[model samples]
Target: MAIELKDLAPLLLKAERTNGDVDPSVLTNVLRGGRVANDRRKELLQVIERHPVLSDRDMMYRNHDERYNFGIKKAFHYIKLLQEGGYTDPVDQQILYSAMGEPTAIEVHRSMFVPTLENQGDDKQRAKWLPLAKNYKILGAYAQTELGHGSNVQV
Candidate 1:
């Protein structure tokens, strides 16, 4: 699906004309807290949407293993892409994580493992684990309770 600039010219012109004093960029910057943040956000969205693997078009149909495999592949590229684009902010990572579909190791790594390490690990341990976790060398997850505990806890 190739779209030519001319094909969208009319819509773009209409939007520009109707925009008035709105200065969409201003709103965008304000929403993101500043121009730099907004630009990073737009860049992130473009990267994710343009990447073939990051998409979730036919995800629901995939079985658990298939989905997990796709997620692992995406995770590798996710780190590479962000690093290539010079975005090291964890906030940006959170944005990308939230954009993706179907729960995966990345989600658990971010929402659980990272926090657990940060809160519980000592400096020496963190020095060893953080880099691997940061580079997606090792992915992890945390479940709410131990297997036997289930949803019932007497404590």
Candidate 2:
């Protein structure tokens, strides 16, 4: 599978990175921020990989609605697995989102909702809303693209 590197990637990345410097695990740990972070990421990836539902394979042949709905199912199981495994950090949540490959329907929760609360909402507001947001109780979407400058989507 790696045969399509086109020779430029090796030069750009250098042979040392591919086969020298330090152990690959060590490099992965360092790149992932630390040992604990690396282990958590590995655990999450393993959880995704071992399960058939979480795999991204065979998605090419499915219809849009099929894929979308399957992705939603996967997202639900994805969170359940992580939470059940004792993961609480928001950073760990990115593992499932990363595997999603593109912007899914739940993109707003991660991109806009969390940032909006963290940046603007006071502690009381966050305390009341963040749990629901975190647990997917209130799935929000950024619908700004659907609203023109004059439109009032608030209602």
Question: Top model by lDDT, which number?
Answer: 1
Candidate of highest TM-score: 2
Which digits, one per residue and each the tens of the lDDT, describe model 1 over residues 1-155? 99999999999999887987788778878988799887877777776788887766576788989877877787777777767877678888867765665555477787788788888999999999988877778887665655476756565
Model 2 worst lDDT window (10 residues): 96-105
Q: Write the per-residue lDDT of candidate 2 for residues 50-137, one digit (tens) a residue.
A: 7777666666788999988876777776667666776667777788667655555667777898788777889999998888887777
lDDT comparing candidate 1 with the true structure: 0.77
- Model 2, stretches more than 4 Å misplaced? 1-23, 100-103, 145-155
| Cα shift from native, residue 69, model 2 (Å) | 2.0
